[model samples]
Target: MSPLLWAVGSLLLLSLVYVAPKGATYILIDDNLDTELAPPFVLLQEGKALDYRSTTVVERLMNGLPRNALRPGLQPLVGLMALLDPLPAYLLHELLVRLAGLVGMYLLLRRYGLPGARHATLCAALALAWAVLPTYTAYGASVLGQPWVVLALLNLRLGPGRWSDWLVLVGFALWSSLVLTGVFVLAAAGMVLVWDASRHRRVAWRPVLGVGLLALGYLLVEYPLVYSLLIERQFVSHRVEFDYAQLAPGGVGAGLIGAVRYFGLGQYHAGLFLRAAPLLAAGLALAYVPAGPARRRLVQWLAFSLSILGVVALFCGFYPQLIGVAQRLLPLLRAFNLSRIHFLTPLLWFGVLVLSLRRLPAGWLPLGLVGLQLLIGLSMNPEWTLNVRRLLGRLPATEPTYAAYVAPELFARVQQAIRARTGQRPAQYRVACLGFPPAVASLNGFYTLDAYQNNYPLSYKRQFRPLMAAELAKSPALQTYFDAWGNRCYLFSAELGKNFRVAAFPAQVVHEWAFDAQAFRRLGGRYVLSAARLQHPERSGLQLLESRTAPGAYWRIWVYQVRN
Candidate 1:
């Protein structure tokens, strides 16, 4: 088959794979709440961009950064979504981005000198199949920067010999740096440049210098912005201290083993069938290939892959003891997800495998493997598709037929209750959820004090910690309870709720105290929505205004007026 036909075929297949399982409703993992749902909602409602630093309540309370610290790469897409309905726009956007990434991957493979046209086509098809596997689907949809990161990596491999290439690189670099994953792409590009220089025995000064200056300029401007919003505000409440005991079983070796297993194979049940044997075989065969661009590229990728995996394992495994020494020496490493390092691993593994198989005939071998992977992905789709269906309430999961997870009927009832009781707009009142997931409230377009996000301002935590302490002090059982739970438990209490805007205490603390109605009123909470019976609801002075079950009688939403 011609390369064009191959490209079109792969695009169609992957598009179907992506769209089939997705609904015109939110997917509830990772940044679905913060990045996917809230930002676009805020942009449409307020006619401005919202990101980690901007949409956050503490940032708003402090009037901290005048602008969002996040890059505006996703703004254009978000703007377009605002013009249409969010659910349809999100599904369409996901389809297009995945398609674009696939095309870019094919082009990158072709440029990497993967021998014949047929070989390149087959390799690209395999890579595309691998890319859309269930393991990555959730992230691909929720994370805005992913497709751009793929395109940026492609440009990195293709190099910046041309003026246009340089321009594209700079543009993508600037745009991508808004997402933390983009930073890793830039780092990978730097490694590529270093490898090129080492291979050629001379510096590629122009691109090297160009990347350096651009990065330095970005950091100069963005560092203060991030530091102010994140570091200075103590939003790094999620910073994890490395613990050696958690690594157990085998210490560093066990950590490395777990990282390799989870990162490479993924956590999904389908991933049990998606073994690493073929990819590992390809990697091992890299040693036998003759010295050339393909071999050199494979070597560079392998080294890059191992380096990322090793760094994460070493830091997480040895933790506070050994890793703390490194953290003191290099402070920036303090705030990072060791597991996220795996985000790039599958792609790199695909590169190594595809390049290694370039010499084989473009026939059944690649096609069979691709088909098997696709089948595995399809098998997993039913559960996800069912979930989307359940969430969207039997509505067609298509464009122009979007529905929020909170049924329109239920939402209207809740709104009516609040309006009747408060004589104010829903957005005017700071709302909290007692037993329901916070996202449900946020999805219904309420200005909920409850949220689920990564970072929270330290000020909010400090303000709230006293209430928690008071509660714990009142209940010796609670103090004993947390003492059993440990330090990581306390971190969530300090950070997660305040950052996410959830009004209730952290799970570890919630069971210990009766709901403090006076504390809720003091914190400016005017409404409390509960899915379960509230503890000491009378003491909290919460008046139940309305109660009704959601669609399918799954759970009841109880709206209460917080009597000041």
Candidate 2:
């Protein structure tokens, strides 16, 4: 079969089955839109631009704006794609990721496979399996950053003619997700260089040079915007702490597996996949096969590096989350912004397919592997881990609705009143919430704020404001007061609620709603809801309106609307 033919087949398979999971982003990334605007705290401070000194999301978001000092040179490209298509850039990112994965497989095979059309066909077949590997496509397609990171890895060694191409791929890599992925690219290049030198008795400066130039191009394009954000946006002050030396396992897998058993995901992917799994065993059999050509050996090295990533990903799986807790503070590693750690499979196996292509038995190996995957798919968990949720769901739990919102809403409502009383639009507004979503809602534009380090809750809890917000605002030679009180509004979710870390208010409002979780369980487990505005229509906008808008029974919202 022709390589082109295989490429077509891979594309067809990807289109049919390997797409983003509809609800996968629900836990953190999807529900949260503030990440697109900037950090919540920065928006609170009403800084439309970012400061150069900081490397946080707030900084990147603000810097991406035209007026920001630390400009995102490539963020506009993402934003542009979003604008042209009338789709969320998040969704658009999924599109890019799928394509990048396909292309990456092609390049992987091109570089390592035997000289013939078989290389392309094998790459296609391998890509088909990988793209459909529930873990890789569904998990990864939902993410914007990981796919770009995969592509950047592939283009890091493109031929000499396209400086422009290098700039785009590298730029997208640095621009998307956490900027630390750029560092990942650099490390990959170094590892690639070392492998080449040792394996062939000669260092391949070209690959190394390509990667370096790409990195430089990334920084060159990104600096102006991000640097500005560093100066302009307070949220830019936040930093992710990563510690490579302190690697440990976490029970990410268990937490999820527990969820699965509790929620039925246990019966979905893993359980089903494991039941008739010989095909999986056979496909995997190829991964462990013996040696191939020198180039194939290079593929092996890349695969090894990816395996190390897989091991690192176990941080999200085995240590029961304490390890992941500590991971948030770690430097470069934190920026990988991994939600589904399993997404690494495609990137890793792309190399495996490339290296193992030569040794693949021609006759029935491909069909056999596909059969193994299909047979195994039955036992694996198709849904996600839901044990804790299911266990808790089985329990009847309730807390009083009174003041749950006001306890936090008082300060917030007062701030809203104050903003209304003053009739000033503070230029930009930010509201500190569990995440930045509501803060972005306070006004029309975006804000700079912090997330509670992805899904892992802040160890600080009530003090999370001081812990989460203040740190997000702190830059060199800064005061604690400056960091803590720097925001305009704070939103507290009464359903899953907290007062956060700060206490200040001139305006606030609290509204509550009640929904029977039991009703949903009884009615096919569906929770129905609607919202009403407590405050009059005249009170909408600024901070005052949040108190006006109240949710159904299952939730309550407490808002602190600050003066501009």
Candidate 3:
């Protein structure tokens, strides 16, 4: 290996291994860990029978059937990684990320060799920029399939070496939903290759056949998502707006952790460069030089086009639909469901910059480019922040505390009560509980049936509320309980005679998949039953069992046995 490339490799590895690890921590309590994302999918795999949206899709694929379910609101993305093991896909995806990085770097650089070292160096710079970004890698990395988009980019740039390259692109689409929007970045690039081959009069059949094959492959692979989105979009109003006024810089200070979330973690950090200005400058400056052959003129053209379409496509897909709400570009810019869609923006910029700097002498282009990136990043500095300090001060393990706060420690107590009454035979019970943070995971351990969130925030319409209220009225004793969607039945804490601003309804939210503005409402549980039931005691064939109490600030359980 050449010394220059070897030196570049070492630098990349050291920055990711040493500097990156020191600045980040992945445990809960930081608010950004987003761990709840994976539990349900893994829960199903652990033999519990239930499904979230992603899990539903994957389940259908594995079980060989199409689902007719339609869910409302944003759902968690954790189901994919959760299907494998006990530990909720944490370390597994990190390993995949590291592996993708290695593969991305090797293939990316190899492809760059044709363009010569200077341009190749620029492509290398995209790695460093995205690696440090918060949305791109920081919180986003906690997600398992996060790196495949960039990995797919690497393969697309590899210029169709083996037939396996096409398979990799298809594989990436299956693994993560984030790539769904940005995938056209690849589809567009592939179409260009077909165009170029036909223009050059070379092995033209490959490009034509590849595009046809790619189109058909994506059609088959994305059938579920395509079908779901098409039908869903037609009936319900996603209310997604893209009113362009939010592009202006606003009060995105320390408390607003989501400010640069759209810009990618690397770009986010780089955006506030006064602290690491010099270091970031070094990274960006070093990003513009590519190494390799002069025959890559065609490939370079394709990269440049992709770089443009990628930026435009990202803006169009999300921002245009989000204009009225925050009027913010950063939020809309997240091409995927998460906020890190801007990670590759720097990649495109670096590509053009590398092309520009390819002719410069040793060290000259690198220094100039780095300085430029810092100047631009510092331009958006959001008044100094305490975000870093707050992050460090969070509790080491927040899952346990959050668990206790959301549900009572009823496992051992419930197990004992059931065993004493029924000779310890765990039956296929059809148990039900109010949906909360920990109910589904906690209940399936000893209950009759699987647990799930009844629906809210996503599909909370005015008509649905009365039906739910009627159910609550029929079961007055369950006033303090959670309903099918896991909402409170109003006896414990009624809605206090008001509708929520977000939803404009008389409903309450227990949990949401992602941040929906409508979720920040006052949750209420009221029964639509006859006033007779509320005033008089209802007789039942139920008998009292051992009611073991749990001491906690959250759930208050009152257990009984039915002679059904």
Candidate 4:
């Protein structure tokens, strides 16, 4: 098949793969379901997407989560949620991100790595594999648009670039997060410029200007972050108290092991799959291939990419220790995760795959490698894997369909029942969740005192911490997780541990519920929505309000009202 045909075919297949599940079955947990969906939905629903006031807040989560804490509403992907329902909007988002990746990888390969029609099929195949990588859709174009950024940089560096190259950088800044992706991308670009300057013995002003433009774009797009961080410091961020030592993987020995693992497999958050095996095999194979210009170019590219990964992996492994020293001088170093440089590695690994495969004798060998990568990438996707498992009649009971996850009917019933019993609207009283994410309730229009927010007021964290203080005291790990890193300021149970997706069938009961009723009430927390049944209800000053279950509901929500 031709390159264009292959590209079109892969996109159509992806549409089927993602959209076929629709509401019945798809991933609605972790970052996508629990955290990301609610923010955009709330912003658009309340007509607060464009609200740029410093006081602008979404009352759905973290007890008045700042608008800046959520993704910017102006971005095209976020705006899609305003036009369409969550499912369609999200599917479109997935398609758009993958499409960006496909085009970006193909363009990068054609322009820099593999030029000419002879290499088109190989380029398409490699690009197809990259697009299929199971990255978090919530990240939008951050992971996927990386190749485009690199292409733009190379264009500016090599020659007088087209206006299209500038457009690529601007579009990237608009779609991607400054903290999650922008910082690292700019830093990587700067490092490359330094490397280039050393080789050429002079600074290339054009690419430097390109990098400056990209940075300026990020500043404009993510102005809220700039406002919060620099312009007007509203409240202390919970990240200020981030204890790197406790969060890091044990001592120096474990850190070294982590570095080695990172060098091989890459980080899980960055489209991680069967990266190490194929890349390693290809590199080893390339070493023994007959020496030529093609072989030399492949070797040089592989060495350079691998070296970057090695340095990044080592830095990440001992990040905690490095931060410890740095924080003593500049305390904010604790909040900044320098390890996000690993986000760039997945694209580099794919580049390695392309370079190595391009050097091989064309046919089944290259095709097989691409095929292997595609299968692995698809298998790693939660939505795809779940659907595959369901099709094969082997899906686990614990796994929930997207409909079951966002059960509007179930939540509506719960909402109506609460109103009938208490004569109070959802906005009148705050809710806290146990053995489940507070985001579930928040998305259902409940005012939750607890949430899984990336950024929020440090005062809120302190206020919420007291309610679960006793529970934290039970487990040292939980104590560190809450006290040090308190992003998930939910009502934690010692018995439930970290299992947020509680199944109703097994009826997981918490024997000892250590909760402070006064503290909860002080935070205006009138309702406690729990998945687990408490052994002694009165012990926590919670009276069971209602316990409801339905056919397709993920949780058998037991509503408990605090005794006044």
Give the range where candidate 3 is weakest over 10 consecutive residues by summed lDDT: 525-534
Order the numbered candidates by TM-score, best leading.
4, 1, 2, 3
Q: How do all models score by TM-score?
A: 0.72, 0.51, 0.48, 0.95
Q: Give the top-scoring candidate (TM-score).
A: 4
> What is the lDDT, from 0 to 100, of the residue 304 in candidate 1?
70
List model 2 lDDT by residue over 1-564, tens digit each. 665466556545534322223211211122223233233223233343333343333321222222322234245434433344212333344445546555554554555443466445555655444333333221222222333444444454444435544554555544442243454545655776788679889765556666666666666555644444444533332323332223322244565554333222212211112312322332444465655675466556655654564454443344335435556555434434442333333344334434443445555765565445433332231211221232244311222121221222333443455367556442334333431233233222323232322221122223233322322333321222222222222222343233232122222332432222232222221111112222321232223334332221212334433222
Candidate 4 TM-score versus the reference: 0.95
Q: Supply the global lDDT for candidate 4.
A: 0.81
Candidate 1's displacement at residue 164, Å, is 4.6
Considering only N, C-alpha and C atoms within 3 Å, which residue pairs clash in candidate 1? Answer: 242-319, 449-501, 450-501, 450-502, 451-500, 451-502, 517-540
What TM-score does model 1 achieve against the real structure? 0.72
lDDT scores in order: 0.49, 0.37, 0.35, 0.81
The prediction achieving the highest lDDT against the true structure is: 4
Off by over 4 Å in 4: 20-22, 277-281, 284-288, 291-301
lDDT of 3 by residue, 1-564 (tens): 643364346434533322212223232322212223323433453433333233343221111112312221122233434355322343344334434543454345445522455444444453333233222222222222233334444454445545575565555444433232335444555666666667776644544454455455545444534445554532221112212323323332421333333322333421223223323432443343354554256346545544453454445345423443443545433223322344344444444444444444557545456445534442332211122322445422222233343232554566566667666533333232222222322322432211222212223332223423533454443322332213321212132221111111222332211111111111111111110111111122223354333553223333434323
Tens-digit lDDT track for model 1 on 261-336? 5545544422222435345446445755678997787677667755655565454444434544566676555455
Backbone clash total, candidate 2: 99
